[model samples]
Target: MSRTATAVPPQGTPLRRHGRTKIRYRTRGLAWAFMAPLLIVNLLVIGGPGLASFFYSFTDWDGLGSANFVGIANYVELFTSPAVLSAIQHNLIWTGFFLVVPMSMALLGAFLLSRVRRGQILFRVLFFIPYVLATIVSSIIWRQILSPTAGIGQALQGIGIDWFADTNFLGDPALALGSVAFINNWQWWGFLLVLFLAAMQGVDPALYEAARLDGANAFREFWHITLPGIRPTLMFLMLMTVIWSFLVFDYVFILTQGGPAGSTDVIGTVLYRTAFSENRAGYASSMAMLLTVISAAIVLGYQLLRKKLKWEV
Candidate 1:
């Protein structure tokens, strides 16, 4: 042994590499086992339906018989139809209001509510209650409340002033759409305010204390610390609001049925009418697909905005 050249092991090397390999193999097995159910559900429920809808969108299926594939003919018809086009415009306008009005108001409300000590929980409950109600139910209630000669109308008349006497809330071409959009805001902002307040609490208390010591008041602290801390939540909400705005259907359906001379029409209701009422399933599907593209573009733009924000934390 002494006379023979001794074999040397490599420096800082293990005698066996199998330990790490075994651990990694076990970890992967566990991960896959846990993920198996979720993967199955995703494939069946989400992926399957999505693919079917994509296939359906290319055909003129009346939810019966063999579907007739029409390719880009439906798309061509979508851009050419005035009613369909007007609904797209309404959807854009609705998206604008959803982004600007309710979200801004929610942020302000959350900020103010965070400063309160007593009855804060009650305030949250009261505000968020409306969000719990179904959109269709809320729309129906508002329809009654804003009735030209029935609900709020009679009350206003007793008060010696005409409220709905001049114009119908759900029946007027000019005011119906705006009124519906406004209701959407009213029913939505409270939930958003709660969400903002919840996200705000996750921010470090020490950051606020430091700001205060530096002579930074509430406004300054919010601008520098709070905004940055809650940036992700705000971004997510903004994107969601845009989608919901364009997809609004229950409220519009219940309130105006996409009427009041079609002033309250939007992409969702337009799609419904095109598919069922007009028996233009292919064209409706095309419009729907286009709407989906627009929504995706909006989401992409918001993602770019988030990157530009450069949130470090």
Candidate 2:
């Protein structure tokens, strides 16, 4: 019997590479398919406007007509202008208030709720109710409550309590900014409380039991166990709070319009007024760029700190 040999290619031939090529191509196509819509939308909405703002920040564009390049003049004016300076100062103060007030209230509220065995859901709902309300509705409700002529003040005056009877919270320069902060806090702290409570609920029960067995009080347990356990959530919320404080606009604009003599003016309001009211769109773009830079710097700093300290979150 005669045997005929069939040709066999050596190992690592191109014939075996076809499968990997097909897989790679398929994976790339699937990825693009999933990402296409989001990428397109982001390009249209964010990237376009952001690039335009960056370009216009170096020019004098009045929202119409030709844009003339002005170099860094707008930034110089932004830093030197007293209104902008004051607005920046107000932003700092707002950030401080949010960092301290809402964070403290939320942590305390969440801790208390976490310890509750009865009516926890009811208390949570009540606390979160204000956060669920529309911003406009909340602002109006607070405005009425703070109204001197026909609201709480008058009601209190009728009952012979005059402490806030004559107080014009939103109209007085000294009180306008603080009043807005208070109103915003009223709506904000509850949301934070719910978030913190959720974080606390995720904490290991064994940790708490261990702490109790060690004769640790509630405060010590919270300081040592709860805080570290929920560090990721707490840190994230703190970062967001800082960023939001800088971008705060709606409440101040609705309640005070950056007045009582611009006492409550923040960078957000100042940017709005500069762009639309004063017809300095270029300058407003500069302000927007400044805000973007600040936010970016904050995020970058956080990332660096996390890397340096080897934070898991």
Top lDDT prediction, candidate number: 2
lDDT of 1 by residue, 24-47 (tens): 899999999999999999999978
Which window of ten consecutive residues has the lowest lDDT sum in model 1?
3-12
Candidate 2 CA-lDDT value: 0.94
Which prediction has the highest TM-score against the true structure?
2
lDDT of each: 0.83, 0.94
Give stretches of model 2 more than 4 Å off: 1-29
Pairs in steric clash, model 1: none
Residue 21 shift from truth in candidate 1, angstroms: 5.2
**Candidate 1 vs. truth: CA RMSD?**
4.5
